[model samples]
Target: MAGFFSRSVRATADEDAGSDEAPLRPIAASDAVRRVELLDSFEAAGLGWFWATDAQGRLIYLSDNASEKLGWSDGEAIGKPLGELFIPERFDDPNKTQRPLVFLLSARNSISGLNVRLAFTKEEVWWEIAGKPQFDEKGRFTGYRGSARDVTASRESDLNAERVAQFDPLTGLANRERLTTRLTETLTSYRNSKRACALLTLDLDRFKQITDTMGQQGGDELLKQVAARLEQIVDSEGEIGHLGGGKFQIVQPDVDDRGALGELGQRLIQALSQPYSIDGARAIIGASIGVAIAPYDGLDTKELVTAADLALYAAKGGGRGQYRFYSSDLKNSVQERRRVEEDLRDAIANGQISMHYQPVVCAKTYKVQSCEALMRWDHPENGDVPPAVFIPVAEDIGIIREMGEWALNEVCRQAKQWPVELRVAVNVSPMQFAHDDFAQTVRNALTNSGLDAARLELEITENVFLGDIGRAQGMFAELKELGVNLALDDFGSGYSSLSYLRTASFDTIKIDQGFVRGATEEGNNNAAILTAIVGLADALGMETVAEGVEARDELELVTQRGATLVQGFIFARPMPNEDFVDRLANGQQTYEARGPAKYRAARKTVFRRIGLIHEDNRYKVVMRNLSKTGAMIEGLLEVPLGTQVVLDLGGGQLAVATVRRSKGALQGVEFENPLISDGAEGLCTRHRVSPYQIEAAGRPLAALPQDPYSLIMGEQEGAGSPRQFVEVEVGTPKPGTGY
Candidate 1:
């Protein structure tokens, strides 16, 4: 009911007596009163709010309407501190973009259209406020006055715009720009503290084929599902972003453990590779991951991203559905892959590719029942090229279809020449299986070679069910009508479905090699799984083939588990077509297992030079074999058992171990901590030497060096002791020769 500030605040300020400009003219008494009424009317209309705080920053007077809007009466707000009026919402969330309102006010600075949140409201409400510090005519401090207007609608609109810019519209995951910003900021902040982070880039395999088969909308739904699965796996450990279609990026801060990052990558690939149902359509797509750790791989955003991308390229080249860690030689590896892919284009025409047969023997009688035709590619320079490497390349270059048809015809032709009653099985790729004329192709193969349909077994993997299930079922019926037997290949590897067994008339289920490899390991449940698979197959009137039975113990275990057929190196390595016929003519139809009697810890045969450190002395030695728990190293003649040492396995990896066994210059050392899977077919140490440690020892921060100890070890470290053992020269060991 009392007087308030004048209508034109600047005009009122001009009425100061000591101002430089002439100001003798002033408003009359009634006009001044009218201006006060106008100011009150402005507040009454709710267009804006008026507020005044004491010199102590406490509220003296507040707009009645603004107070009422916040569920507060003037009595409730008048005596409250100005800071208590606005409390910011969650800073990490999208609603908050302002924080300087209180800081500017506390500093007695002019606030111009500053945004702040209003507290004590049931819902979030934002206001744009402006104020100036008040003073007496003598310049003594007094309470301040300011104006505020509701900006919640505008604020919400701005937030929506930001979200649209920062997140993928389809998947609701962070978009590329936001991801880049986040990685850049993280790397920048971490660099000063000498911390570590990791980047993992993913590319979805078979995504284009799936999209073509399922249509655009279905493809979009699949991307959303992928994002959901990523969130479930990554959770809060890192940030996930959709870097455009079918490509994703993950940033993990304060994490440099390769073992842990490798596990995360593996889980991501496995989860993404599983079957997805999109609007009644089932699909399967794989993921390839590339990993790069900060400082070791790169120190900045561009270098790290480039390194990760190169690693991803290598992963896909090695074979999709795999993950690869960044290495300095990855550029060379990628170039080698391109060369291999190019050479594969003319392989079949040049006679560089041929067929070899590995027999599928009966588990009980140990007699050859059938043969699985494995393809071989002999590059002029590379000699023998693995199917695992070339097959994926063929598929990528669109040559697998022609090659698959060739294999089918060649197998039939070869089987016709066999004097024995051996049915030959041929592998089928998913891309070839998806063709509408695949059944016709098989028909042509059988007719061309004058071979019976029953003698041709077509091996199909779970990937064949990637697209339309009904369409796949139709293909199955057509193939069955052609009288060619079908066997599920790589069963239990992934995407196993009993519904497939129901609809498709598969004659056999070939258990994946992975199940057989670890069946005999202690505490492993693979035996039970093998038995269950056999039981299931038997109940369905189908035979089961246990694959990869190398050792005699694996052979006996598969037999005991009720597997009807077995295939692997224990029986014999795959022989050429000429040798296959020779063997049949020579009456060598039965195979007795020739592998080691019992299974031991699986160790990979390797031949690489490594550094063995004992005390202050480092010795260059050859590592012949490596396993999770131990490795065989050669050098340092007559090394004592139980002596502690460290193995430098490159890339700054140092494994602490104790010698468990010794034979002359060769020593078998057991690791204090076992190595873990590197998200692929290799094992790596869990932790590596941080470059910061090297920097702390007086070197500038940089990427990992070939020998980190050279930078970390002090000069006096060499004065500790002389060499304790004699160094022996290591000759190159022949392949398959035990240390």
Candidate 2:
């Protein structure tokens, strides 16, 4: 080894002296031998490793000590491809232009401080290597020499720092910075291709309540669980990022269709809104999503993020557990929501809220067994305000508890006037139920109303179980001791667990309307879920009520699934107190199912102005209700039946339809194709006119403007034909005719 090292040193010195003008001193053979020994000693000490590769890139020599450190036997790495021995580290940054070791070797380029991960190691090992390309006297490639050192320890620390910069410490999800960078890159890339991307900005609703009840550590744990659930939902569809606190963002590329986007958003809300167990305590939280699509809502990251934020604000304001799509009107909607929030405080304080009751009747007997009390607000200026609009505002403004207590008292008082056989159920919010004296609140309401505790049923949602489980159990026990019936409302709606049935004492399980809404449809799993829930309830000696049975097929399905009670529009719409009392006065305890005999497409009542296009002539009309299959419209005069028209439903959605039923100014139009779920609670056409298409037609790609039909028509040749139908005032009554 000493003689070989001395010869190698002399050859290297001769080669170097030849390249320079200065002459090098000749070394003594004995001194050169000693120097070789010294080099051998240094290699044995493991200070560093020397390696050489052949022209074909196969390893020719490696330090014996280094081979042992890498868990390789002596001569094991010899003749193996050097590049195959290690894999280069890949950087995720799109700006990185680093090439692999094979590329450098093939190009005969010098490598310096290049990091690569060793292959087939029990533990991750990284090596930082430097090598210079070698050449023969004829300039032909020969081999390469390199020095290598183990960088595993330092590389780990570097990776840890990078992870910290990119991910949330608590949830292990991409951090805000990463999300922003990703969104920016996605928007920039998609803009050139004219592709679509979606952004869902969400924040946990009532998260502070959980933190206040369970402390910060528990909140952190809950966030981790939430992150896990979101990952499960998103799976390869896109990326999920933690935006600090309880806020999160999801980026999905090429997902512009409202139907798919809406489905994804709803799935996120439903999954995250379910109950969570931290340690031994249960915590309930909900999420609201504001969704914005690139190229439609905005073309840049900041613009899209702002649009999504506004949509999320609207969703939270509408109700805490819903999702909303970004629209041009969302900005105004946010301001209007603030006004509603202010008015809600006064409404709760001034007793401006009222209750309406919908009966839950026996499936077999069709006799009214109980009625669920629903809260309604009749604002002096706003007229009729939907509970979905005001309830969340009340909760946010700290008026929910007061409003709930008022409703409980009012329901109990009203129940006292009903027949003794009838029971009244009042909806209980989790926030209101979490009060220290919730059981006492119930007792007081019953006492003040002079109503029997047996006749007053408190309908609590699964959300009530989210908190300290023991405390919730205690509250349930105390309420049960007061002789009031307890019903679990919206069972199996979100984060459902059989453990809830085992531990919590509930008298009934009301299947969520979501399950019952389309249970009868083919391929829908709701029927199976409904059956399982009813079986679970029956096995637990609890009754089951199926809510939202709007059609006869739904009624039949729920009844066959062994649900004991039914409640929905199929039985009757919630009636005012006077109307409810009048029915009782007339001995109308048994209500017959009077909805559509067969299942029909669900229709949403929407009274908004829309454009109706016929033969290039666009007419102003009001859409009264919209469904997947068709829509009922008014505000157009004397439209003949079977007239083909296109209804512009805004946001570039156009529904080609034929007037099926036309009488006077009102008509029912059947869509040429069915609409799909918009991902929240609405329906939309599957396809919309792309902004690119609009741009090619010389119209700017911006937020959809009012009367899209007019813009589309203006671009067509000879689109100035006079309208065929007269536009009637929306709210004005037609003379000598009832619409």
Candidate 2 lDDT at 621 equals 87
lDDT of 1: 0.87
Which candidate's lDDT is highest?
A: 1
What residue runs in model 1 are displaced by over 4 Å at the alpha carbon?
1-38, 55-57, 93-114, 132-144, 714-717, 733-739
**Tens-digit lDDT string for candidate 2 (1-739):** 1212433554554456555567655556677654775676577677768888889998888887778877888788788888888889897555565889989988989999999988878888889999998989999888899889888889899889988999998998999998999889878877778888899999998888888889899889999999999999999778899988889999988988777877878788878877777887777888989988888788788999999999898788766788888877777886788788777778756767888989999999999888889998877766778887887878887888988888898888888887545888899999898899989899999889899898888888877777788888899899989999989988877777787788878899999998987678889999999988988888999999998888899999998999999999988999888899888888999998988877766688877788787886777789989888999999888989889998998878899999999998999999998888644567777667677766666788765554455665565623567677888888833322100
Cα deviation of 336, candidate 2, in Å: 1.6
Question: Mind giving the per-residue lDDT tens digits that candidate 1 earns over 1-739?
Answer: 2225544555554356575676565566767654665677788888998888998899887788887888875468777888878864446532235546667777788878877788778798998888899999999778678989999998899989999999899998999999898888888888888789999999999998888888898889999999999999999889999998799999988889888888889899999988999988889899999999998889999999999999898788777888999877776776788788788898899999999999899999889999999999887767888787888889888999999999889889889988987788999999999999999999999999999898889999988898788999999999999888999999999879998899999999999989998689899999999999999999999999999989998999999999999999999899999998998999999988899998777799899999998899888899999999999999889899899999999878899999999999999999999998766567888888888898899998888877887678868555799989888999977544100
lDDT values of the candidates?
A: 0.87, 0.83
TM values, all candidates: 0.92, 0.83
Error of 1 at 219 (Å): 1.0
Task: Summing lDDT over every window of 10 consecutive residues in candidate 1, give the lowest-scoring window.
Answer: 1-10
Q: Give the range where candidate 2 is weakest over 10 consecutive residues by summed lDDT.
A: 1-10
> Alpha carbon lDDT of residue 638, candidate 2?
90
